[model samples]
Target: MINNAPEVLRYAAFTTDPAGGNPAGVVLDATGLDAAAQLAIAAGLGYSETAFLTPGPTERSFAVRYFSPLAEVPFCGHATVATAVALADRIGPGELLFQTGAGPVPVSVTAGPDALEATLTSVEPHVLPIPQADVAEALTLLGWAAADLDPSLPARIAYAGARHLVLAAATRERLADLAYDFDGLARFMTDRDLTTLQLVWRESVGVFHVRNPFPVGGVVEDPATGAAAAAFGAYLRTLGETTPDAVLTLHQGHDLGRPGRLRVELRAGDARVRVTGAAVAIPADVA
Candidate 1:
């Protein structure tokens, strides 16, 4: 168990179709791989992120780590979802707890006739205001002007497991056409310890479209971002954009030709946001 992991599995989260969602590599039994080996494996897969799991006292619990293409992240929502569903496929769906660097995350998986779905409850979420200067600088990197931002949503840094700047576009067109200065944005994010910019546009009362620029992860863009979705839900709840108890739907990756959907739920008394979606394994041939 030193160098050789039991198996390396590839799965896509937030969508039932492997071709639609964000892809992640999962090692269900990574009992011996160290941080360097984990980083190498994640980089080799070339996905935005990958997860490694070490068994805990019981089969229902494990210590998990997430590695992006460049570095180790405290947590990753999509990867967590993928791992839970992958485990469910073998052990049958129920509950699984993952001890992550950020905190403990509890995931519930349910097996259905069509696919396996997983819902992950995030840690307590909070929001903080983004400095006007910082927001302006970010906008400049994105090639967007102040007028392009939706005045109603405002701007803030939201965090559930990771931090993301919540910026709302005035229109869907603005959100769809994403071409940013990658290096500049990367520098800005790294300085602020930001994971991705949650560039979003509200389509209606409960539906929204989003795009995430994950330069820090060494990816141009994330087709589907579950962590951002959870953060955005907390942002909305904080801003009174949505009711404290509401279900919101997010559509992502369509602009990249890989469409994925995520469901976000907020409870009245609970501060933790629940992000739910289905994950499917990418066939070996497709990989």
Candidate 2:
């Protein structure tokens, strides 16, 4: 329904540098754009995902939809953060609400020392066991063996907004060599309704290194993935790995050379996980 091309704002989420974090296309006002139009824009941009926003019932609430190059997804964490930071740049930092396919997400934007940061509180998250057969198939696609998996962190399907299969690598080297069967993994994920494979390695008690293989989203890998980080927090909590009020640090994108950091916080008595990160606008010429 859009007669003209809408202005798309590009921002890199989870990093202060425009080139560091995961790049997400943000359309602040996608009022008349239909699903096809939105998908076209997303595919043209060719980022991991893009977010479209329309006015909601409340003044500060918006109906948000996310799309990757290949398909529409339930939610996208990095896009949400990028959109919030972009809005804060225009309207100033404050609280905002986003109604998404997964559920209602409340985001708070605040001024940081270096740049504006946004924290989105996810809907209640849950973790479920992955069937051994499915896990074996995924491992085969990654060329990883059972012994390469860390015993401490068992494979599980975690969901905050989108679903991801959490796999822990026994060693950092194993996590870095990530060449995989692209088409096969894409088919595997599509069949099982998986968004990404969250491959992680713990550096310390509260610090971790992560990578997201997003074949289903038509990307080889995601530089920084906020939704997977949120789901990881829930997965850790369900495994009794951390305290109720644990604040975990996730380091991502180093392997791809676009380093980004994501902060995952678990509030006491609240099942919802909070992910905080900084975002910077990418110039149109370079975006």
Candidate 3:
């Protein structure tokens, strides 16, 4: 075992129940922990991602870094939400700024009916058209055909704090069946610096069922993805799919047996997207 490991707290983001959301390891005080140590802890924990927090320049702010099992990531939404809730539980609900690799992220935490809800405002988000050849390759690796895609949403690469391939499914059934070539997809994503594939199926106006294939993170899938949700919101905005000011509901992780809900908000004139979700601490033994 590693010597003097930093205390790693466990929390589940985007769900009130411990077993109903994405779990993330949170190092509340990683002042002296180096990248190797953080990566070790994250790898040992085997969560999709872990968050390391160090004091920032000002009060109520922290310099946070995220690590997957294999490598460090610029940003991770679920881990951010987990860290924010963990901090709120100790410091009381309020606003906190996170200095992340992607950029400075502002988060607000408030007590919800059942759990603490944290809202993270993403950096200015943008979308880019993915090459047809790349999309075709991705479809082949995913065992999906061109007809499986939803022409309304179109395929694009979206960036909020991290890059994600946004692909909408023509039907909920297509989105539900998510057996993809892990190794092939991982290689594909690594070459393109993609964090996850935001596979979605629109349920109704401003409501969607989403799933994230996160092979690049060394995880097969992410139960609740905040970054991808933010990216998806931006994608919708760029496509003129929703009103300037709109609230979207995303249902994710249900197929994985860890159902979670994310609330995505877009404001008029603001290029940033806001994602809100509840998080709860996981008991040590349970975690």
Backbone clash pairs for candidate 1 read none
Q: Give the per-residue lDDT of model 3 (tens digit) for 204-241.
A: 99899999999888999999999999999999999999
| Model 2 vs truth, CA RMSD | 1.0
* Model 2 worst lDDT run, 10 consecutive residues: 278-287
Alpha-carbon TM-score of each model against the true structure: 0.97, 0.98, 0.99
Which wins on lDDT, candidate 1 or candidate 3?
3
What shift in Å separates residue 47 of candidate 1 from its native position after superposition?
Answer: 0.5
The local lDDT score (0 to 100) that residue 93 gets in candidate 3 is 93
Runs with alpha carbons beyond 4 Å of true place in candidate 1: 1-6
Candidate 2: list runs displaced more than 4 Å.
285-287
Candidate 1: residue 233 Cα off by (Å): 0.7
Query: What's model 3's overall lDDT?
Result: 0.96
Give per-residue CA lDDT, model 2, range 81-190, as digits (tens): 99999999988899999999999999999998899999999989999998999999999999999999999999999999999999999999999999999999999999
* Whole-model lDDT per candidate: 0.92, 0.95, 0.96
